[model samples]
Target: MITTVQRPTPADWDSWYTAGWPAVVTDKESESFHRTVQPYPGMTAVDLACGNGQWMRQLTAWGVFVTGYDFSTEALRQARAAGLPDGLSYAQWDIDAEPIPPALMPGSLDLVTCRHALPYLEYARVLTDVGRWLKPSGIFYALVRVADDQDNATAQSDSVLESFHRGFTEAQIDGIGIGWARRTTYRLSARNCGIVLRGYGDSDCQPCDVSS
Candidate 1:
């Protein structure tokens, strides 16, 4: 049985991107997230932990000014090599160790997207900070990998490898819901173990109650 596998460190992530991650989401799945945001011209968005700039490319294509941030240098290198268009830029940051960069001003972002990347760090804290950075009408769109009771252990075999921690629970998702003006969730397929969460931020909502 698989047991006692260590969580991925920054260096592990660097190598993961170097070797490449085989992203398995469908076009419909990606379109679902895009449809939820409906990002328009002149909108500013940040894609936290953007691995290889997929979302950034989509958002920029929709005329959104987008910044893709990732801690892994190799990931950023790969993203930059993709020939990012105008209205798109990238920054290297260790989200768990630092505050959101000052350039990404509070209440100035139209959207913030984190796709399949939150489980590698302190997601709760990251979500709270993301809530604070958004504009009143902004949306926090995340495709998160939720934890399950199955075996996700890493081994030295030729099987498919998973990089993140176990996953998040329902309570954690609900805790995120409490802070938004409105929140909607769509569960992905069994292969992903993910949920597409879109949280709208407006003036009337309370701060995220993460204490639970």
Candidate 2:
């Protein structure tokens, strides 16, 4: 029989981050992205479910206008406390909701980065919205959970972690990147079973590489 996992509230998430919970994506992941992405000044981007706004700070430092979205009050508080310079902003929203906010309009962004947060939301719906929100030449960056990973075991048990509810497949990623210009995917972990999806809108799409 299938069991239900309770979702964590904003306060719970805040406490988790405050406790210095380590993030899955570190220098290696960011290096991979920076190597692939060519960020220009005035570029508009969004960090979906941005925790503590580290990625947003990086983008802002690179002169990209960044908007961060998250529901955790404490996380946002930390981000604000960092004293964001111009070109950075934040919004609070439950990403699982049916319609995304109007601020994330269709074809308006140059990039959208989502890390370790896809499982909590309806994966397909969020993917579709990300695609629509991207400009014709925009890029989508994501680190998503897969069903085959041991991390998914929580999905079989009663857990409050979002990973328990989120998983992905190559076919689903393909379906989401229908019109992407270039697509590169890599596996990040052996034990966790996660994949990094890098989809560009202006370049020619390439074959999916699962070997990583």
- List where candidate 1 sits over 4 angstroms from the true fold: 1-7, 22-25, 151-162, 191-212
Model 1: what TM-score? 0.80
Best by TM-score: 1
**What does the lDDT read for residue 207 in candidate 2?**
64
Write the residue-wise lDDT of candidate 2 on 1-212 in tens digits. Answer: 12233557777787777887736456766666676676779999999999888878888877999999999888888888888799999988879753588898888999888876766666666777787788876777777655644545655455545433555544444454544545566655643333334554435677655435
**Maximum-lDDT candidate:** 2
Please give, for residues 1-212, the per-residue lDDT of candidate 1 as tens digits. Answer: 11333456668778877777636447766666666556788998898988878768877877999998988888888889988799999999888777768887777787888877665567666767777787766777777656544433332223435544345555555555654566656666553433333344445764443210
**TM-scores of the models, in the given order?**
0.80, 0.78
Model 1: colliding residue pairs: 147-167, 147-168
